[model samples]
Target: MNFKGILLFISLGSSFILSFFLYRQWSLTNWFDALFLIGLLLIMVYCVMVLIEGQFFTAFLKSTRNFFAKVNKKDQLIRESEKRSVEPLDYRKEFPNRSSFLQVGLFFCIGSLLISSALHYLN
Candidate 1:
């Protein structure tokens, strides 16, 4: 599975585990309390998933660094392109798919938050 898929699985799994622990301590018998705990765990799960999968974000960043490491220095671009597999310097000239890492992540987070909030309200 991809990192995002792994992250999603980890997030859901950890939330359930935490909910289990809270269930035992606070209200083992009450279904509603258990459910509420589960719902609350979503925030924690997001936090943990972000922590663990931060490396993926780092990887994306490293890619961007590779991309920008050539910016304004076309002199070195040709040389750097020779050393790397991705040819980041050529990409800006050819494809120009210039989406920044932060913009992509902000989009993802906004989407995820919306979906999670909707699910919370529905549940």
Candidate 2:
């Protein structure tokens, strides 16, 4: 398996193990609760991963800086000078294959929801 596939396997396994322990600790009789919680957790992680991959915060900061720069011409000049001195960092290099994370999270979430629904009806 490729590196991403291995990582995905590890993440899914860890999440299941963690949720299983949590389920036992909480004294829950139903497996549905554990699965549901795992699904939600994975989905949330996927959302965070996507946000970081997209550099949403960096864009937000740039816009905020621009707004402040417009309000003060002096500050804008200083900001321009700083920008010229600094090189733009490639943030994408830090996180590769973000779609894999999204897919894994969604798969777990949807699978859990379906299983929970089945269990609910069966019970």
Candidate 3:
């Protein structure tokens, strides 16, 4: 129930409705055109999601890396008495409740498409 979920629902639902209308109105005249339009809409959605996901993950990883890098030891210990080891970043553990919304958004898109297809078939 995040913003991405709401937006995806609206976007997918609108496209599905528009596709249905095209199918009903012009399908007989140019069935391939209707199909092509629907396919293009789906592809566009897929590409947008991919781009968003890529940018989100890339920025997330970079920030995490930078956070660790900023705290890193710049100088090595030359003397045993001055030895101080910088702790390694524990990225092996997952961030609490992080990026769950993005996955939920992806699921929302899938669910919307399935529901739209079901309704379309019923009609």
Clashing pairs in 3: none
Model 1 spans with C-alpha error above 4 angstroms: 25-123
What would the per-residue lDDT of candidate 1 be over residues 1-123, giving only the tens digit for each residue? 755455445544554565567655533233334334444444455554554454445556667877676564874666677865444322211212222223333444555456656767887
Q: How much lDDT does candidate 3 score?
A: 0.50
| lDDT score of residue 67 within candidate 2 | 70
- Candidates, ranked, TM-score: 2, 3, 1
TM-score of each: 0.26, 0.57, 0.28
Cα lDDT for residue 106, candidate 2: 72
TM-score-better candidate, 1 vs 2:
2
lDDT of 3 at 60: 73
Worst 10 residues of 1 by lDDT: 90-99
Q: Residue 109 of model 1: what lDDT?
A: 52
Best by lDDT: 2
By summed lDDT, the worst window of 10 consecutive residues in model 2 runs over 85-94
Deviation in Å, model 3, residue 13 alpha carbon: 13
Pairs clashing in candidate 2?
Answer: none
- Give the range where candidate 3 is weakest over 10 consecutive residues by summed lDDT: 89-98
